[model samples]
Target: MLRKLPLLVGAAFLLTAGPAFAHVGAGPVDTFSHGFMHPLSGIDHVLAMVAVGLFAVNLGGAAIWLVPSAFVGTMMFGGALGYYGWPLPMVEAAIGASVVVMSLAIAFGVRLPTIAAMALVGLFALFHGHAHGTEGMGLGVSFLPYAAGFVGATALLHIAGIALGLGLDRLGNMPATILKRCAGTAGAIAGVSILAGWLAT
Candidate 1:
């Protein structure tokens, strides 16, 4: 449908842009701007974050917000742990796995009670947060502003995902369902690729 044009275009842009900036590292995060750009720089993070939004939308009802909220809140806790130099084993692997789980859920149209959904996303958020925290530790920047920037950017990515989900829902039929599934499949492939890269490195 004509309505899907912009969303498709945006998705295209992100897909193309992601690899060029992928996980460049936290070395540049010496300011709020740098912190904000950190997540955007990584394809893995973007995929997982957007998948969270899609998963929330698929669940419908309060899950639309609750799931993302849980992720954000718990992610902050994980970030704090990272900032304090706490050891969280397998953080990178966990993050990659989150992408696989979330995207597969969307692809299969998996539904759960709001509480369960929140817990699922929250669990993944911890790994994501820890990554940010660990990377940000020695940046010598003001923690509050840096945190705020990254959090704000994350929220924006979620909103973009939700917006796409909502647009598909508006189509109100098999087309929407197919598109959602396609999105999920693409996400799944991305997850697998990230995990593979991690293994190689």
Candidate 2:
């Protein structure tokens, strides 16, 4: 019973995750504030970012940090492309797919080589960053501060996921693994809902 609290919270998050789409607002306003709030505003961003952390923990070893770092670093480059009006194919759909793919990774406890895991998350970060970058384009905003804000926010979300994974790990292997996999399963379902247009993320 005690160990199940986190699972309940995770379930609540997923259930309530519907309805918040990416880039929700009237228009780009404050640079730092908007960037900071942007990732928090969208379900897709939150899910994918957190899933990255969870996936990292699943991989264990150096992957615990390297995977998330690769994502942030690559996302910045992707963000730059979007900010400058460079087009990437299937940006939105790719964002949705990132959630599905990453969540499935967590659900199945998939482990790849550290480099392979880093490359995988890096690929998804490009689309996520592109979305962030494109959001502020044409708004005459300061790219550095805005980018910093989102980067900071993304890192925090990743940390939250890391904390969740680490906390569950203390609860004995079998229970913890079951709960983590359950989270991944729930997240995958939510990702599917977003892709299907039922959740509108």
Candidate 3:
């Protein structure tokens, strides 16, 4: 549990600070940098991306890679919709909901079939990608690099979650399970806090 303190603290910080969609209009800058920074700028993105990784580790097996892949791939497709100005209703709300659902899944040690897990994360990724896409609105040619930047950042965050999850799991089954649940419960509370913040705003 001590080993996981930093990550838990960071997640808590995400819950307490930053805008829901801080990436919506990143200023003029290198497209890649802009995109890369977007995910880091918001609490919602960090929580959801990291939670996907935790969920993957909880599922175990091929799901470790497949689930994250599903999210990234589907997220890109959703980004395209946003880039093209296709409307996705309730994107912010959906993103918040994703955090709540995914974190709770981890908290409870819920294990769905690999395909179902993939689909669940993939569905969440759409809204995430759309948020990224819509942010790059007029970037035109720069959108690709911006998209790449965010994708790269998302992948890194997922890996971090996986590493932390795996590390906790190594502490012995019961201890690991307890720690993961504690982390997930914190994440779920944070997610709810974020949603309430959004509603208040």
TM-score of decoy 2: 0.85
Estimate the TM-score of every prediction.
Answer: 0.83, 0.85, 0.85
lDDT of 2 by residue, 8-125 (tens): 4244334433333454233564577877887888787899999999889888999999999999999999988988899986666667777877887788777888998898889889
Tens digits of per-residue lDDT for model 1 on 78-117? 9889888898866766777777778878887888889978
The clash count of every prediction, one per candidate, is 0, 0, 0
**Ten-residue segment with the worst summed lDDT in candidate 2?**
17-26
TM-score of 3: 0.85
Q: Please say which candidate is ahead in lDDT: 1 or 3.
A: 3
- The reply for model 2, stretches above 4 Å from the true place, is 1-26, 139-141
Model 1, residue 22: distance off in Å is: 8.0
Candidate 3 on 58-105: residue-level lDDT in tens? 889999999999999999999989988999866766677677778878
Worst 10 residues of 1 by lDDT: 15-24
Candidate lDDT scores, in order, read 0.76, 0.79, 0.79
lDDT of 1 at 37: 79
